[model samples]
Target: MMAPDVARVESAIEQAARRGDFDNLPGAGKPLDLPAAHDPDWWINQRLASGEIDSQALLPVVVLLRKEFERREETLAALPDERAVREYAEDFTQRVHQDRRANPFQRMLAPAWDPEDAVARWREVREPRPAPTAAPTPEPVAESRRRRWWPLRRRG
Candidate 1:
């Protein structure tokens, strides 16, 4: 009951298998976890998960810039000193400046990050945290701790 095209394709696959065309290929033995529905980024995500591509290398310039912006505070925290944080922030913002798109349509793929604002935000993240202060003591409750119970109602 198989369609002619399906039968033809099956015959072709059998022939290829006999010729060892599918042997020794990468991930040949491993089963792929394909989704039931179509996914545009599935391959890219798989490549990242399999270590075939680095996160930074796989990410687009615009995406990378956005990721940098999102991780700005964490990056600053990881730096040994404020100067290092400032340098990183400056470089990140500069790169973002280089990739900015002027056209409104094209701008969707290349986001603009203001270098000055990035630097300022970095400075804020790098500032020393204030010393912890004791929390104010709670005031005692003023309501009476009375318990009330309803007596069984007399048969109406």
Candidate 2:
């Protein structure tokens, strides 16, 4: 009763499972937690994970702009000198402006990405992310339900 495509996909998955492809794989038994709605960045994340897609080649000018800025920031961080950093910052700003001008959606362009803030953005990207701190301890368990945040007046 299975559709051809579905059966083929199931067979492939079963074959992979039999070949030990699932053995010791991280989160093997866990459910897939997908986003509730379609996510724009999810496609790019999947492309990057596969190693087959060149980030630079991916489309939609805004996405390219974001990725380009990130790449530029990484390159600048490694060899940042005042002159080089200043030049790249200026060039990056110019490129962002060009992208905005070329974008078909004039509304999406207006005040969407302020190229003027590129230098500040660059500084943020170059900064290392702070380490994850331990989670704050939960509040002590209350002895009675009546003492909870909202005191309930239970009529006897």
Candidate 3:
């Protein structure tokens, strides 16, 4: 009942086996190393573990938003000025609002970031710490009277 192409392939494989083409190959006669509990997303997990793909790519929009919220400091710090930070916060808030509106039934919704709060936080993080008190100036050291060493003869 096999298709002609399949039967031909099977026959060719059999001939190759008989000819010892697959003998002594790597992992011959060994059982495959499979996990005891099958994971449906094993390939995805493998890629994530090996960093072949970005982890954020597989995250839900809400989760991604939450992660962004958590790292807002770093993101805002990279911006050149307060205006850029304010714009970023506004954009982030808008996206959160949009996502909430679009996915009303989603179980885990990311809380909307307050643009004012974000700006405040950015300012707080950007504020320069009070300059440390200047250390007491060290007393001037007396010049040493030791003669200098040199190989050149005095031309006097």
The backbone clash count of each candidate, in order, is 0, 0, 0
lDDT (CA) per prediction: 0.72, 0.68, 0.84
Question: After superposition, which runs of candidate 1 have C-alpha atoms over 4 Å from their true positions?
Answer: 1-49, 81-83, 101-104, 109-123, 144-156
Candidate ranking (lDDT, best to worst): 3, 1, 2
Task: Name the candidate that leads on lDDT.
Answer: 3
lDDT of 1 at 76: 62
Give the per-residue lDDT of model 1 (tens digit) for 42-96: 8877778889787787556777778777776787667776566557766776676
Worst 10 residues of 3 by lDDT: 141-150
lDDT of 3 at 119: 76
Cα RMSD, model 2: 17.9
Instruction: For candidate 2, give the lDDT of residue 156.
Output: 100
Model 2: per-residue lDDT, tens digit, 116-143? Answer: 4545665676778999999999887767
Clashes of 1: 0
Deviating ranges (above 4 Å) for candidate 2: 1-56, 70-73, 104-156
Candidate ordering by TM-score (highest first): 3, 1, 2
The Cα error of candidate 2 at residue 57, in Å, is: 0.4
